[model samples]
Target: MYLPSFTLDEKLAVITGATKGIGRAIGRAIALAFAVAGADVVLISRTESDLSKVKSEVESFGSKAYTICSDIKDYAYIINELDRLIGARPIHIWVNNAGINIRSEALNVTEAEWSEIIDVNMKCSFFLAQAAAKRMKESGTGKIINVSSVGGHVALRTGVVYAMTKSAIIQMTKNLALEWGKYGINVNAIGPWYFPTALTEELLKDDQYVQEILYRTSLKRIGKLEELAGTAVFLASDASNYITGQTLFVDGGMTIYGF
Candidate 1:
């Protein structure tokens, strides 16, 4: 009775971008983790084949996983489909993990690139959170986890637009948590530095870039997928019940470096 329970038993979770990179890792990890913890998961992604793969993995863990193959940018349809799929089940966890990056220099950033990143990263995330919040309010308890980045905290040379959206998410997480705390909704974010995901696969291949990354990271190594996923699980579980409106940086000390 003295120990706090971190079990997600009987809870339901929805994870966007559940097919690749950080999203896939987090989604699959969460799905499996949640399954072991006794929760059902809803995986949202754009590819049916990939969704099926993750679905199989989740089912292997003996938990039900429902897959939705749709672009998160089309959040309206996604939300509607979600309602139809779940049918009155209160969502206990919602992870906005779908995102894209155009990794261009500031001056070379095109309007199309800017719009695309903003739409998927910022716009889609907000509306989805809004729709999720409405449903969560009905149940009086829920957790909303936004997948932000270390780029949001410190300046990154990746691209201006991508950083802008991430920074905005951090702010959004705070404001939403403040507004929704009364309704028993906890809004939070996770910022990662470098992980071996498809998103960073190309960059990590560059020795110089890897060296630069290691120089900044106190841990001096790229993060493991499970490490990042563990952070998400903590935020989603009852362990973080009293925590909200904060971005947990899983950056291995990258944000703390200054010279």
Candidate 2:
């Protein structure tokens, strides 16, 4: 029997928003996962202190860890910084996990709020992928994982713009896969449901919201952060070589089950 190769040995992965929440979880989990398989990682975030802490955690797994303290909002700066850190080395995986959401109703949303969400969640993600893809294209192989949300597929009460950005992300993944498949670049997305993180803390705290979420989900409970790690590892490794332009919804059947 031929078991699939899930090892990312000798690979280098770059994760944005690596300081906190899902990004932090993915950063640490993937770093350690890859390390256990013999890979190095580069953690990127706006906070130097947090980056250092994560770096220590990654290094604890006996893998080399590098940190980049910069704002993902600044497209040019991030691209330049990545180039500086990576030099001639090819990035085997790039996870675009940096995003923000404002919980305003559609009528209450402002121009500033709209732009900020678009800038950080959409614009920044695209440019970063472009930069990573350029390097990956040259190397003739790579993996790009975009962190989308269940809101992308089904509308949520969170905010209109946030849902819109995530929906765009799903489409973006497909488009990128179509364009870059020839270069051996696999572009895909992961849409998660209610997971306990800094971003969803307040929402998860509301009993009413929690009940609603559970009712819709087949698992009838929120997801654990660790539950997402395996999916990320699968996509980043050689096991998902034939999978591209796909959105793997890690939600607990929230997307498939309709009310």
Candidate 3:
């Protein structure tokens, strides 16, 4: 009998921003996928109730699920909580999916908004990855998947700070992979374009905004959350063991399309 290498059996995956939108979908999908493949999951979010709900959903997949309520911007709190929950448990995968953005032009972006966005999207992710990597280093193997955005690669008319932080994520992925490859830790990133997540809900409601997005996208439609989940699973599983230090863009060709 031959089994596929894609199975995550016996592995443990941790995902942040597990409450809503792309993060929620990725959390659920990864939990179920890993469960089906015989692995357990840990979900983290800002809301305990929502985390509990996702916990129930993941547990229904016949895999153990642990939930943590955390504000990603609070680095110390998150790291401490993670250490407490992960005590002596080998974490095979860590997904840094928590992020925030403010729709403001370059000149109009406030210091508070800029600070918040950077703290959540970049600073938190790096610190969290640092914490996870410490454990992974001990085990000599792990996967870290950062949820970046196509905005990181191209200039967007949206929030300039958001794009800046995302761009940093891409670089961070590369650097981490380069540094951690010796310890068998693979660091990578996923860049998604227009998706129907809560973050994009308001903009998607605008017909003109939607049309403008589709105009540059070869698929001419927004991405589905499951698609992003699939990519996350691939990165988390052994299927992508040979891959690292790369950003897989799930943008429906939007990044490559030229006006």
Error in Å for residue 104 of model 3? 0.7
Model 3 per-residue lDDT tens digits across residues 1-259: 7544887888998888888655666556656666677678888888888888878877887888887787777768877776787679999999998888888988898989988898888989999999889999999999999999999999998689999999999999999999999999999999999877778878889999899999999999999877877888889988899999999999999999985
**Positional deviation of 153 in candidate 2, in angstroms?**
0.4
lDDT of 2 by residue, 97-199 (tens): 8888898999999999999999988999999999989999999999999999998999887589999999999999999999999999999999998787778
Ranking by TM-score: 1, 2, 3
lDDT per residue (tens digit) for residues 199-232 in model 1: 8888889999999999999999999877887888
Ordered by lDDT, highest first, the candidates read 1, 2, 3
Q: Give candidate 3 regions above 4 Å deviation.
A: 1-4, 20-22
Candidate with the larger TM-score of 1 and 3 = 1
| The best candidate in terms of lDDT | 1
Cα RMSD to native, each candidate?
A: 1.2, 1.4, 1.9
- What TM-score would each prediction reach against the true structure? 0.97, 0.96, 0.94
Q: Could you tally the backbone clashes for each prediction?
A: 0, 0, 0
Candidate 3 worst ten-residue window by lDDT:
21-30
Candidate lDDT values, in order:
0.89, 0.87, 0.86
